[model samples]
Target: MAKPCGVCAGVRRAVETIERALVVYGPPVYARHEIIHDRHAVDELQARGAVFVDDLSAVPDGAVVVFGAHGVAEEAEHDCERRGHDVIDATCPLVLKLHKEARRLADRGYDVVVVGRAGDDEVDAIASRIPGRVHVVSHLADVERLEVADPARVAYLLQTTLGGLDTVDIVAALKHRFPRLATQDGDACSAVHDRERAALKLARRVDAVFVVGSGSAVTTRRLLEIVAASGVPTRLVENAGAIEHGNIDGLTAVGLAAGPSTPDKLVDAVVARLKMLRPVEIDVLDGVEEFVRFRLPSRLRHAGERSSPGLGGAPLAPGAALSHDR
Candidate 1:
């Protein structure tokens, strides 16, 4: 097993927020987006009366709503207020940090450029706040095509999820193209780098590596890319049941990793299933255990955790609702 597995600190806080909100308020606690981009997590919450909607308008007036871990555009936050929704912002703190940088750069009269996948939710949120030209670049090839009005007065921000993970080379390319490019450079948190490094290392020792996470999650896809690039046989599975597709019946050694947005219960389920397939001993690599956590809405009081009648239940609690004005 790879170290630093299971949900990251930011994701944990977001999942907990929704779970607690459902408890504090009762049936039909609304969420602005799929919290954490994991299907199992969202489905479990939904069964417990967590209603997810892409638009704030879909939620009833004054209803309790929570934002996803990836965060949302500044305009969406305003929409929640305008619609009189008791909104709970479950945005990951790391994403919130990038949003702050975006606003700051735009305020300083610089064209904000973001290096990430164009249509990603995180990138979209960052771009929506900038009032000026906001260019999205992915590869080095995209750099030359950029036609910013003011190259000398350009600042670039990175999408906080997997897109920004280990993108120093891309940042360097942007700096070279835009002579006066401003950046807080290499600002991705240490945990992000650590997790990637751990996965890569695990890939080398094992003949095959199975990453357990949602297919839609940014972290899961990035981890798959990193492991696959290491010249080791790698496959992504949503849970242990998908492990058979890795074709690992004859592998001498195997590595397991869970994406940051995945729940430990799912990982545990995977491990239990893996053990049932064959006799194996569990081992964990040495790495930093992250303890970072962000603040939740003031109304989200941690009363206690109890089973919420979801498939493979999780700790659920009840709490208060928050209006933006409060």
Candidate 2:
């Protein structure tokens, strides 16, 4: 049996809340980017009448646009204002905290090095927040390319969803180059750390580990990397169909986990396939449990204020607690 990953479960719950509210409120709920980076989640929302758009231009003038969980660049927020689209920012608060931290570090005259996928919406915002002060690096080797005015004055910030062990090694390499380089506390989200730890633990108990996640999900890629780094046989599959018969022919134990953005249903399908294949025991390794909850935007909190009527309805209130579907 496949269990829901904490992070994906939380996001799934959040998406359900928004969809239900839209039902009470009407249609054309324009979402900026995949709501949680899961194709299944996006497809489900689309079936329920949510329109996912990559660019703000797809949204008509005065339409309501909801931001995805990964968060958007400040420029995107400004564009929404300029375009007159009613904005509902669903950026995970943990990511927002990192963006703010990166900006704060940049403002203090320190050069910043951001470690993450280049051109990612979140990375772009972190770079934009500091402009000239920030440089992006995806691999550990790229750390040598940092062009800082003073190595001593440089600080490193991470994409909140990056792999935990990978960041440790990357940061170690950077510190070797610049011993005096500053760093922030708890940059990666607790959820990412917890899931990575869970994967590692599960890896020890199984002959092979299968990480179910979308092809483009950054965190999912990291999970695969982490498992492979342990020298265990690991496969990263987008769905159960990718699971070849030969891969699981003789494995007595198999470990299963999904990245933060994956859907619970896809993971379940994978587990079901494994169950049918043989008598292997499925296990969930004990790992960190996170209790963090992100507050919804003001519009989603209160009943009196409706999300602007034209797009769908009026905005939700600031302090409203969304219903949890999981």
Candidate 3:
């Protein structure tokens, strides 16, 4: 049975910030990356005058630019500042917190180990912020190859979207090698923990599993791996259109989940498509109920407040609401 699981608070905040930016700044607003990794969200923003570019060089001088939810390298931020671009930071606050922790660990003279996929945008950003002291490791093998100044003077930071089970093994490996190693104050963001736990529980009870999210999204890929590890057949799709009927044939019951960047509409579309594929009864697999809401950047918040009809007497665009919800 399909369930209602998609779009965490951070992702929802990023999208809404971009939408409000469009409403306030008009056309040609620039985004440094695919605002969140989901194609549907990127396409929708592009259709509404959000121009996404890889490098700051692609954006015009003095234009308003938004950093993506995954965050960006320090060099990218310097470039934006050097180019005189009016920047609206849409980086998720949890990721910002991770970056701060990485810098603090490095400043404390600890050889920092970032436990995540090398070259992932978030991982790169976190590592880049710590300069010469950061090392990235995906598994125990990577940890075995790590060379540091002192085994006792080491600290580790986790990528916010990594699965909890995978993190456990990696953390254990780090601790085994460096008995004095330090870690972040808590587990990865609560959103990551909740979604992964729910997905695993749902995957265990189903004949097959379908994950709705972009292939490039790390969280979605992690979800796919975790579910598949449970011995359940699983597939990762961008949307309902990508589902192949033959692959799901003869399945009596199926489970559905989506990544943090996935929109609710995609989940609904996949659920509707599943019903058309076979006469299956749909049910919601209850999981953790998320209620976290990240505040928008100051610029967007001020603009939204002024643009509200009741506040400044200026009418907002139709369908635009000032509230932030997950």
The candidate that achieves the highest lDDT relative to the unseen native structure: 3
lDDT tens digits by residue: candidate 1, 1-326: 88888676666777777888877888788877787666877888888898888777788988988887777777888888898888788777777778778888888888888877787777888889887778888887888888877778998877666433558788888888887889744456455566788888788789888888888977788888988998998888786677663466778888988667777778788889878887878889887765454555567746543332222334432332111211
TM-score of each: 0.85, 0.81, 0.85
Query: Lowest summed lDDT over 10 consecutive residues: which window, candidate 2?
Result: 305-314
Q: Per-residue CA lDDT of candidate 2, range 210-292, in tens?
A: 88888688788888888889888988878787776788888778878777777656776777887777765655555654444
- Which candidate do you rate higher for lDDT, 1 or 3? 3
lDDT of each: 0.75, 0.70, 0.77
Per residue, candidate 3 scores C-alpha lDDT tens digits across 18-59 of 788888888888987777777776787889899988777999
Q: List ranges where model 1 is wrong by over 4 Å.
A: 163-166, 190-192, 244-247, 302-326
Query: Model 1, residue 10: what's the lDDT?
Result: 68
In model 2, the Cα lDDT at residue 249 comes to 84
